[model samples]
Target: MTQLVLHTHRQEHILRLTMNQPENLNSLGFKLVAALRASLQEATRDDAIRVLILTGTGKGFCAGADLKTMNHPYAPGEPDVLDCIVELFDELRNFPKPVIAAVNGITAAGGMELMMCCDLIYAARSARIGDAHCNYGIVPGGGGAAILPRLLPAAIAKYLLFTGELLPADKLQHYGLVNAVLDDDQLLDHATTVASVIAQKSPIGLRRTKQVANEALDKSAADAIIHERLAARDQFRSYDYREGINAFLEKRKPEFKGY
Candidate 1:
């Protein structure tokens, strides 16, 4: 049987995970979700991996949950689809390393939600993105409904949610949802170039920065400041922090140990 997810080490510190069920547009089937979750767990524990890139093979980044299995009867004690989706997304959202979503093609509904979980989103010019749940009379079980509004303006979010219309990546970039839109042929190269830069930074600094930033979203302004201050103080105690400062003074590159 073919692998549900393909794992490639783009560099020593960069991992690219490609959803491989192109025949079904890489839909989030049970096996695919399990594979992705397992990959994420392994990446999280591997200190050498400092960045992750998520994409898909063939014509779709992801078409969302496997529709054919949506209403099927479950086997005894089988995991609920929504439960699995929630777990996978939660892992993505809280992943310590930076994740870049290279949206190469059609990304709809939960596919878009998965992209949103990444730290950065770079889409191909031909990539179509939207909350397509409405097209199938399905309510979004992912962040399409809740977190999307926070990511984009309320009106724009509502339009995607209500219409189920797919928008070009450039259009979403105009709304500040996508970090950049590149030509189809340039998407992966651009994503890897960006990830390579991030990989050179202090790993602990990036992890702490991500932690503080994600937490700040749910915090009040004053509380966010305090949280950031505490996080910074903690980070200052790390070896990478001192190495960074000394490296600058000595005009040499910092050798970060990811401590």
Candidate 2:
């Protein structure tokens, strides 16, 4: 059987996960979701993997959950589709390492929610994105209603949610939804380039920074500052911190071991 997801190591420390199943527009199926979740679990435990890049193959990134299976009645003891998606999004949102979404093509509904879970997003010029849930009369169970508003202006988010119309990648970038929009051929290359730069940073430092950044979203300014201060104080005592300081003083590159 063919793999539903393709895992490729890039620039040594970066792992690129390509959602396969082009025939289905890389829709999330039972096996595909399981494979993705398993990969995330393994990557979290593997210190050598410092960064992750998520994308899809063929003309579409992800069309969202497989509607065929989604509408089917679940067998006894089988997992609920919403529950599985919740678990997947939760794992992705709390991922310690940097995760970049390289949206190469169509991204709709849950696919858009999945992309939002990443730390940063880059898109191909030809990519189109939207809530798309309204079109199918399906309510978004992932981050569409919740996280979308926080990520973009309320009006813009609502527009996407209410209209169910697809917008080009550049338009989303204008609304601050995407970090950058590159040429179709340059999407993966650009994402990998960014991941390579992040991979060279201290792993422990990146982990802590990501943790603090995620926390800041829900925290008051003063509270977030306090949290950041505490984390920084603790980070100052780490081996990687000392190595970084020493390396700077010695005018040499730091070889971080991720502590």
Candidate 3:
């Protein structure tokens, strides 16, 4: 049976996830979505991993779901099509480790939702992006409607969804969808540098901060501040946290075992 291909690599505290379907521009599909969910679960369980960076191999970050595969017979109790997409998005968004999307090429439709799930997004200067569901005569059934507004301004998100038009990488960088844009030749190098910076930080601190940030995204300012203070209070009491604080005071680099 055909399956989604993925590549994994771990270097100390960093976990790199690479979509390995350059042949089809890393299109998402039933099997691919399932595989991604399993992979993220495994990543969360590994104490050694402090950061998770996602990218695609070859020329395409992801081209959204595989249109050709939609013809297959569905299971009797399959998940709601929209729910299935949100599951993947949620997995990435709520990951304990920092999640970064290295958008190296085309990202369209569901692919845009996947990219938006990451906390930080680094796009290749040549990448093209969009939500093209309306062009197919169906509204976007993925989490883009809910996720896009969280990532960008309401007017821009609506414009993109309504028109189903492709936006250039530079344009998205200007629009704030992309955090960093580098020349295609420097894309992987730049993304790796960002991942390394995350990996070098205290694992416990990074995880707590990421969790707090997610929790605060939708909360009132006062509640969010309280949530952050409580999370920090709990996290800073950990053994590794104490060590990190001491290391900072001593003017030395932290050596975190992800405790």
Best by lDDT: 1
Give the Cα-based TM-score of candidate 2 against the true structure.
Answer: 0.96
Candidate 3 colliding pairs = none
Ranking by lDDT: 1, 2, 3
**Tens digits of per-residue lDDT for model 3 on 27-83?**
887767777889899988888777888999877899888887666666888664456
Please provide the root mean square deviation of candidate 3 (C-alpha atoms, Å). 2.0
| Between candidates 1 and 2, the lDDT winner | 1
TM-score of 1: 0.97
In candidate 3, where is summed lDDT lowest over 10 consecutive residues? 77-86
Error of 3 at 54 (Å): 1.0
Predicted structure 1: clash tally: 0
Over 4 Å off in model 2, which ranges?
1-3
On residues 119-161, what C-alpha lDDT tens digit does candidate 1 reach at each position? 9999999999999999999998888999999999999999999
Better of 1 and 3 by TM-score: 1
Worst 10 residues of 1 by lDDT: 1-10
* Model 1 spans > 4 angstroms off: 1-4, 75-77
TM-score of 3: 0.92
